[model samples]
Target chain A: MKKKKSSIADKIFVACNTLFMIAFVVITLYPVLNTLAISFNDGIDAVRGGIYLVPRKFTLENYQTVLGKQNMMTGAYITLLRTIIGTVFALVSNALLAFIVSRKRFLFKSQLSLFWVITMYVNGGMIPVFLLYRNLHLTGTFWVYVVPGAVSAFNMLVLRTYMQGLPDSLEESAQLDGAGYWTVFSKIISPLCKPVYATVALFVAVYQWNSWFDAMLYNRMKSEYTTLQYELMKLLSSVMQQSGSAANAAAAGATASAVTPVSVRAAATIATMLPIICLYPFLQRYFVAGLTIGGVKE
Target chain B: MARNTKTNAPAVKITWKEVKRQKFLLFWAAVFVIYGVIFYYLPLGGWIMAFQNYKPKDGFLHSKFVGFDKFIFLFQDDTFLKVLRNTLGMGILNLVSTFIMAIVFAILLNEVRSKIGKKAVQTISYLPHFLSWIIVTGILHDALSTSGIVNEVLMKLNIIDKEVNFFAHPGFFWPIVAFANCWKETGWNAIIYLAAITSIDPCLYEAASIDGAGRWAKIRYITLPGIKPTIMILLLMNVGNVLNAGFEVQYLLGNGLIKSVSDTIDIYVLTWGISQNDYSLGTAAGIFKSVVSIILIVIANYMAKRAGEERLF
Candidate 1:
């Protein structure tokens, strides 16, 4: 009788837990769905503001308005270029640093490791860094986004920990065959380090893709060097400021009468969000694996 | 020659032979070390600006020495003090809410018995985390707008008589920032806790059940204790970041009406340093933030050591 009572209690708990989980999922997804609905809704109608899961009067003009903007195309190209270049540069730099430090017999291994780790703790704050970039003539150029961020102390540590786990025999055999440090690193350690490479790549790519502060701070005048996220930021902020005014609807440059700040902002937001959403399914496993690998306390 | 350096001798002298033997590796390492100095350490030289009555036209070398003046001005300024308060208030609120929500979500998700259901829910939870703050704040503004779903629902449910302009109220600013953080990060932050919980041995649960402990009893005794170390470690890490209330959400969502409660130290630095071109004052404020962060980290590390918990340092 006691066992049956416990079983009934377990059933009740499971039912409640299931309901909670369902609610959690709905709450997590509802905002994105609502945005999609509003983007599809006719802009002026959307301002009347009852749209939730479905558009009141469906239209595709908002997307056309967003996609047709010349600045959006320029921004997209810049964002893509930076992500590709930044990830490759950061990976190579961090991996080389990790390889150098990971060597068991290197004379300055511990010293070099300590040097980089100290950087993780504290450094010059923003104004100084900005001034330094200006001194180096990095500001107002595309290289500002790519060069200064080439080395990450955290990613280097993550890569180094992975490299240190490999058997010593791997490198010993490579050295026995007249391969120098470069050959051994490229031919042996790197291929073995693919999993970690993927993790660090995803991390750098996401950072580069999402970053807009650099453009806003350094290249605000250099419209040619703007990023997609910066463009989206500009769109969102402009919309937010004049949200009540119908003047922005015409300013958005859409021939369609339905184009309003609400619709344009929604469409631009979805445009910026699409790549991340699409790639998430495939990349989620790597990031989860990456986080677990990174979560291990040093 | 590598053998000489590898050996743990009482006195090891530098020799050209050893340097030559490892020349290839040494060369590249030196290049990166120089890169580190130029990028990481060189900027630190710019901190001198804080001690000077700095003018960009005068450059670092020509600026007049005015020790502590910028810092004194910062403390005396009412705006700086208010920004400090907003930073701490929102930072603490975000820290507590996000941390607790992540733990709760992890525990609740772990309670689900169906494998597919758990995976699906976890996947969906992490979706918002991948989004940029720009997107997240845009969605938030729309939802909290006077005619948005929140007001619509509240009015429909008869919870309130009319719409509340959430962003306009000083009292609502902190909670809005905290809620935005929780919404964006709860699932992502829970990943670590869930990983910690899963690492707990299943035998603990089995043993507890055999002892006639109920579900809540098992969780209370076993699960919570199992993840305590992780909780402590994460809490310690977050304590060091208590002042970093983040600039993105505040800058994106904040308005002139809510500026008093909305500005953080970072935003203050940007406005004064970059926008206003008061480099010395900005650098002083920035230095203050960096110093406080280091001190907090050191204190948290020391306390963790005293408590016999694992520390970050």
Candidate 2:
């Protein structure tokens, strides 16, 4: 009788869990869906009232305006190039460094680990980094974005930890076959570390794709090379400026309507986010696995 | 005995020769050393600017080094004081709320039995993390505006008489920012805690059940304690970055009306350094933040070590 009652309670628990999970999914996805709906909605209608869960008057005008601009196209291309180059460079360097550091027989293994950890906790902040870039004559170049953030300490540590967990017997066998360190690492270890490599690559790629702060800070007078996020920021700023100016004009007896400004900003946001969002499903499994592996140590 | 002696001598010499032979390791080490020296240690010298009347023209070598003058200025300036308070306040709020939510979420997730259900929930939750803050801020703008969903619902429920401009009000700004951060990060952060929880032996819960412990009791005793070390280590590491209340969200959300509460040392440095071209003062502020971060990390690590917990060192 007690067992039967507990089964009933367990069923109730499972039902509750399902309901809660559905609610969470809704809460998490609602904003993203709303933005997409607003981007498609007529700008004038979107700004006037609450339109949640669906688009009232569907229109592609806002998207047209966003994509029609020459600057947005160029900015998208720049961001794409940066993400590709930066991810590739970061992956190679981080993987190589991590492989070397993970070798148990390597002299100064602990020392090197300590060195990387110190970098994680301490750093010269923005100004000195800026000055360093300036002195190196990389201020206005594309290299500025790719080079400075090329090797993340967090990614390196995760990669190193993962590599350390790999079986030592495989490496020993490779060495017995007269393979050198480089050959053994490249052939034997690199193949085994695919999941982690993919994880770090995704991380670096996402970071590069989403980053606008550095572009804003370091790329002054280089507006031609603005990333997508930076372009979205500029779009939002201009929309605000236009609204403020329109209000001023209205006060001075001018009849100017800025109905679609918010819609256009929404469109820009959707455009900026679409690439990463599209990539998420492909990487979702690895991302979870990677987090589990990397996080287990901590 | 003679054969053993000869072999031992050659073996020792071969190991010594192998050490000399491995020049590639030394080469890479040197490269890393140079990278560290130039990037890490050299910039540390910039921290000296915090104590000086830093002028770009005077440079570090020629600058008049005043002792703790800028730090004193920081204390005296009402704006700086307010920002410091805001940083601490928001830091604590975010840390506590996010920590609790993540732990709860992880525990709940662990109870899930259906594989597809778990996968679906994890997939949905993790999706938000990939969205940039720019996109997140845009979402916030649309959802929290005067005529936004939040206000509309509140008004319909008679929670308020009028529409509330959430972004404009200083009192609501920090909470809104914190909530947005939690919304975006809580799912991703919970993955770690969940991993820690799942690694707990299933037998422990079984044993607890045999002892007549309820589900709640098991969670309280077993799950919570299992994840405590991970929690402590994360907390210790997070203390160093408490001041990094994030720049993008605040910069995007803040306006002149709420600037008093929203301006962090980072935004302050940006304004002074790049906008006004006062590089020295900007560098000084940045250096101050860095030093404080380092000190916090060291102190936290020391405390952890003393408490017999896992230390970063």
Candidate 3:
């Protein structure tokens, strides 16, 4: 709410804020638009510089080159597969654990919670975890992703809090009817917990989609197991090399450079980025509620 | 978890039927405990390798137990100390900049009158948060390149004589990473604060205006004080992640030339323990980081408690 009499300072502040917001919007949008421009522009034109906002000498060749690269399709398929299966597994295990413990009929609730909560305070750090995964012989295997992350303590807690908020009479009626735990969970609680479940599901899905570090750490040089993010990372690293040595390459002789790696790298960045951007608008409604649930403790 | 009045349900305690009925559910819950034990609790034993002359073949069991030798060696190493310096330097810088920027963004966004404009800006800004760091760093690398837009625009505007190799210089490393972090996270970080601001009663603004409070005065007094608890809670929580200045960005953006200013404890552990085959030393470095992190979090919680702010625990 503002006063009816707007002061000169208030007018100045409003003008300044408006200007700043416009500049802020441009600052945020420019790089993304530039990257898009580079991805579409002719490779030579992109490398020679001065391309911004819009494509210069536009071509789809960069995308073709990026998509046509070795193991590109395979990497996409792998990322898709892992994201689906991993999110499902994580949701099932975490939600079940949360729901089961949330039931008052089940004693040892505090102890069950404490067993997992202790993990939040202490960890073996990266080295030991890596070694443990190595010792388990899960590294370099697909199970490495699914098995370790099946039960996220944080997700479990969030789900538990949500489940706690549901009216008990619903479950009590089902219990009186001699409904089994699985029946009660499926026929009643599952329908009731959709919002929080969707929120947690989105978190795991995003985490699964974006993760490259685990694949890098565990899978090592296994190209077959490469994720989309890892493929993009590989492309980026190669672009770095080319950017560094393009001048050297020209001096040493060879005018056969059809497409600079920079263009393909931009294309690859967009490819890796496209999934999140496209899905984000639809999922945007879920994020604020998700973040609040995740950040705030009951 | 249900807060129902179940006192009228007839106390049917210590019944065999109930135990049989509940056994399956309890067993299912116990599976989580089993997984937690195997995945989390067990690896803690591997921290013992930090105190050993660890060799892969021998493992922690057969390795010669050398107490704090690796730690002393880590402290004695100049490179390791410099890595710590770079880590703390970048961590504090990022924390301060991002914290202020996020709050400022929240305050500014709260000042906007148009709902559509506010929502549109907020949506577009937090869009970066969904992106993986690998992608974020790739964008940074592209945009900050020698012949990239930054240099191109600067040179055209007669701001510079030539293209600046931003990544090549160690002195620019901390600020580059800090700004990159601010770009990616500031808007998203402001969301909670905006929610805090919205929760402040409109009557406060109305009352302040009647008292001849300007926009700046109201923001300084009412708006700020409303979000103080939220700010304190966030600060206390983030203090625990101080050591995690992050691994991916530094590892991606850094190279041998800037290694002096780029390496953090995570990078150090990865390079030394895994890559260099010095598992013991890496574990020692990791253990040092973890211990200090735990201490910092405890101290932060204590301070919050003393100040009558929100304590994490």
True contacts kept of each: 0.59, 0.49, 0.57
Q: lDDT score of model 2?
A: 0.76
lDDT of 3 by residue, B49-132 (tens): 989999889877799999989999999999899889887888889888988989999999999999999989998888888888
Q: Model 2: DockQ against the native?
A: 0.43
Top candidate by DockQ? 3
Select the stronger candidate by DockQ from 1 and 2: 1
Tens-digit lDDT track of model 1 for A74-101: 9999999999999999999999999998
Per-prediction DockQ, in order? Answer: 0.51, 0.43, 0.55
By DockQ, highest first, what's the ranking?
Answer: 3, 1, 2
Q: What is the C-alpha lDDT of each candidate?
A: 0.86, 0.76, 0.83
Q: Name the better of 2 and 3 by lDDT.
A: 3
A58 in model 2: Cα distance from truth in Å?
A: 2.1
Steric clash pairs (candidate 1)? none
RMSD of each: 3.7, 5.5, 2.9
Q: What C-alpha lDDT, on a 0 to 100 scale, does residue B12 get in candidate 1?
A: 30
Q: Score chain A of each prediction against the true chain A by TM-score and list the results.
A: 0.92, 0.87, 0.93
Question: Candidate 2 residues A67-182, lDDT tens each?
Answer: 88887888899899999999999998788778777776666656776787678777877777777778788888788889877766678877887887788889889878877777
Which pairs of residues have clashing backbones in candidate 2? none
lDDT tens digits, residue span B45-118, model 2: 76777677777778878888888777676668787677667777777788787778777777888778778878
Worst 10 residues of 3 chain A by lDDT: A248-257
